[model samples]
Target: MSTSNEPVSFPAGLEGVYVCNTTLSEVEGLEGRLIFNGFNAIDLAETRTFEEVWFVLREGRLPSQSELSTFVSQVEALSHLTLDEYKLVKKLRGGEPMSAFRSSLSAVANGRGFKSWMNRDKAVVAEEIMTLCALTPEIMEVLHTGRKPKLKAGNRGYADRYLWGILGKQPAEADLRALETYLILTVDHGLNASTFSSRVTVSTGADVGAALTAAVGTLSGPLHGGAPGPVLDMFDSIASVANVSNWVAEKMAAGHLFMGFGHRVYRTDDPRSLCLKRVAERQASPRIELAKAAEAEILAALAAKQQAKALAQNVPVRTLRVNVEFWTAVVLEHVGIPRTLFSSTFCASRMIGWGEHIREQIAGNKLYRPRSYYTGSKP
Candidate 1:
């Protein structure tokens, strides 16, 4: 151990670090498992609504029927923007969707103006966070259109409300189920980049708005939340099953990373991808066949590339496989979500997670101030 003031060193990007404990979710990379608050996330995606999973993540257990009803009602009550907030989205309409969402949400959450959420009760802060999560789709709607879009019916749930608002029509029930599944599967995934950013922000006693805003900005980074749209673009470029191999070969020869073919965490098929594949199948999307074919070609290409090269036994090969973005692109596109709004839609679900973690951060309250390795000219 360095007895002096030299900072402790860690792997760049802090890979394999365990920073804190949480009851929110566990991502088992080796097993390709994702558990949310002790429930299997795949099962939740199959059987739950946006409201139910949001409840489970924040409340740490499945709600009783009456409890779920109460929670749904509560979310519904919170699912509105003030008139001024509605007007705010009009001004932000032509801007980038995620940027618009971040700014507008921060504005709404700090309506009383920039008070530290640390001063409030944990329950109140959690409530405010929930209010923001609930309000997000409404804000997204007005951002898409330069006017306040109408809701489908009273408290239709997050996916329903969002699908209708964006498409301006009631989507098929199956489609609604598909989008909800995507939202549930993605709501939390341990201390991912954006979630970590949120916790760090709130750990410093920032307002909940500021914490969530920081998370949105972090998520906007392509390495974090910008794969789905490009995944769709790749499939469109491939055009047909027969084109997949040559297309993949050309791209790989040019040193392009396959957008949806691997993951940083999962060595096997991403469980979220598996779930979304099912959703895409159920939707009968025209794009899924091309995506699957392209994925197979890409995987074979990756494996062949690895086998052709010499490697040490200790070397970790890319686990060439489909990830969540592979089918996320298919399902979201089939469900009528615009390509430009892909990341924004991701943020909508992830809002649940950021809220849950930000609350957890403030409840225990430790500021995040990591020391850096000094490799520059000695001071």
Candidate 2:
């Protein structure tokens, strides 16, 4: 350790560093596991509804049946925007979906006067979370389809309503289950970029909406939530399993980055990828078939190239395998969700996580004030 009074050096990008503790979820990279609260995330994804997972992440235990029903009712009740909020949604309708969502949420936060959620009652925080969740799908649908979101009655639950609003019909059972699984799997991951952004903002005593606004902006970065659409684009460009290997090699040779392969964490497979792989398998689609074959060919080529080059074993390799985005693209496509709305779809589920972590950050209530090392010609 340096004896002098100077800032401690950290790894570039703060990789492998624990900035704060969280009870919401943990990502175990080496073992390729994710745990949400005390439950395995894979189990939760397979067995629980998005509402149930949201409750578990925030409340720290599974809700009883009555509790779940009440929570679902509460979410449904909060799903509709207020008159002014709806007007704001309408005025802000013609833009990128995420941009519209940011504006719409700001209106809700301002109208409700819901600043400083860190110090509010649990009920207030819950409302903030619910409002964000409910408003997101509507904003996305309006922006994507250029029409007001339809609130049809046959939608039985939050996920169903979300799909129905997006697709403008009663969603099939298969679609509903797949979308819910996607939401559950993406709900939280420990200290990811967006979650960290949320925590950082809330640590400064910002309102919940402000914190989530920061997170959405952070997630807008290409390195974060911007890969799913491109993954699908890559699939479209290749267009067939027989062409995947050549296409991957051509892209690699041209120094074009692969969209869905590498991850910052996860020494092994991404468990979310594994979970969504199962979801994709259940949905019969030509895209799924091409993706499965493409994944195999791509992984094999990447592995072979890595072995031939023989880089240092300790260095991080770009050979990191398929992440959640690979299968996520296929699964969402199979479920009839468009590529344009993919990142917004991710944000919709992640609102629950952002809220939970924001609450956690402020409950302990330490402002994030990390030190920095400056190297450029310091005065």
Candidate 3:
């Protein structure tokens, strides 16, 4: 018997349900696993460039040297944003940086070539990836600097060249390598909240541009992609080596969740953090030591306070511990990008993954609507 007043129960955890068929990537959260189109991400991070990862995400296989060359050529060609689009990004300032970037993406999607490009079939996903790879940097530049960036001439591959063009000069090899690694690491992560939002938006038949815009909006939230930039800010606030432990304790007492400490999925340390930290170590910067000390104190305190709170220091702290952000900050700072631009740079990297996921969603064509057992209705 069912009645309006009957009580119901909604599932607290979606343990097993076929919510969607996402070939763009898979994440085994409990096991702390991440894979992009069947390749181990850690292995790929060590061996491949961001462009190569992008190819795997979109094409379901890696690019051969000849294929990579052609892909690089196409990506390099798409780096310039049209004049009208640039104007729109310049006008999107004065609010939150992520919001401004998201708005800028929405504006770009409404422009010519967006609609037709996004809805193409799987066979043309490669072309769509090329278009997106090109547009992302321009969008990021306008959002960060509030000005149109000049594109550099010559073929330097997409990640380095796009960042070089945005920064108005070529990056040093180390700087370019850091940016590439960050991009590859961020390219995909299982069914994170933001990625799920992207899948849901695309499932409704939204254009790929629209889906990506929605995903960016999700990523802008503090709980999602917005934490990394602030992790650096936390480091800056701590200031001196002596204040590290006290500062962490004060922040924790104030009920502020440490920006770079734990993750929802990874019970152990985040694999990506390990790789980024190693890169930062090899780079041999001063900030790495500061980050390492900060991380040590924070972890010790967390363990002392709650025995069960032992989520092995996640990527954010590991990243900060090794001063990954500091190294990146130095490079980007030298190139004239402001501190405010860090998150936008992050967005630029993640956009590749977002587009790939959207293409995968479109290919699988499953409505991502998940059912919840009614908790309010009478039964």
Candidate 4:
């Protein structure tokens, strides 16, 4: 650890920093690709269920038919909230939705009886993982409606349960597939901000509940999981596609974020965004056409700005493109997820990722104590 903050060199925002190695997932930024356990994420999203992908992610192998059935049944059986856990969520009402969701995680994480992260054997952690995965959607229901989630018997899959619980109605299979793709695609993506936070918290021997709640807290930031709702809202403010150029120009000139445009990595298009674009178009999402139109104008505006900057400064320009949040807003809205619940809904998928990382961190634990060089003068 460094005694000083800097005069030290590092990537601004730790942009390309590599922390720990894992057999979990990888993000190929330049190619705009995401891979989970050596499987192309898009392929998994298209062909495999979220449960299957999750099994592969945690075990490093795809499940057999019997194994998958067992996993699904276990998840379904564990989905029910106990009387006390149900009561905990009732107190979570009336805050930022994601904040309430983060608190709701404690209903399992801290409220449920589990030893510290170090003491729990792998079986207990595995159970915690399954329990949290199944429990999240039900908690979201309670958090949102201030009542138990209206879940039905024999849900088609994990996505069906979550969508049915949150929306309080049976979702169509096609809509469930769309939501499944979104969930599987987003379940994990390399060492993202929230995933890293989960690993860090668990590395310190905290329980899964504590670590996941921490992850959700990190995800609640506008810079992370909070952008999707605003992406839909951005379209509402634009009068028409013809007006998009002017709107983009005004926002850029004002030093405002373009809502759903651009990513920290991924110089090319974002793969998840592309998948959701296709899903939105196929679903005939009300916002898809406008999102496409606005995306074009935003890209052109960015190019013009970058070209001017290049001519003036002769420095290499980094490109920014559409990120997952753009079409995620559209498709999730098309599937009946409220704009406000967009970020919380993200937790439904990501809790699995957080659990996986937390388990990994605890297995070969190392305290995450990174160093920084101090820049301030000594007294």
* Per-candidate TM-score against the hidden true structure: 0.95, 0.92, 0.84, 0.95
lDDT of 1 at 345: 91
lDDT by residue (tens digit), candidate 4, 1-379: 5665558677877777888988889888888889999899998998999999989988888999999999889888888888888888888788898888888777666767855667657788878867887888888888888887774877887888889887888998889999999999999988999999999988888777788889999998988888988888899998688888788889879877788777877889999999988999999976777888999988888877878888789887867788899989989999999999999888889999988888788778899998767788888
Q: What is the C-alpha local distance difference test score of each model?
A: 0.85, 0.82, 0.69, 0.86
Compared with the true structure, model 2 gives a TM-score of 0.92
Candidate 4 segments exceeding 4 Å error: 1-6, 375-379
Candidate 2 worst ten-residue window by lDDT: 310-319
**Best of the two (1, 4) by lDDT:** 4
Give the Å error, residue 324, model 2.
0.3
Clashing pairs in 1: none
Shift of residue 42 alpha carbon in model 2, Å: 0.7
TM-score of 4: 0.95
The model with the greater lDDT, 3 or 4, is 4
Q: Name model 2 segments beyond 4 Å from true.
A: 1-8, 118-122, 311-319, 376-379
The backbone clash count of each candidate, in order, is 0, 0, 4, 6
Residue 108 local lDDT, model 3: 71
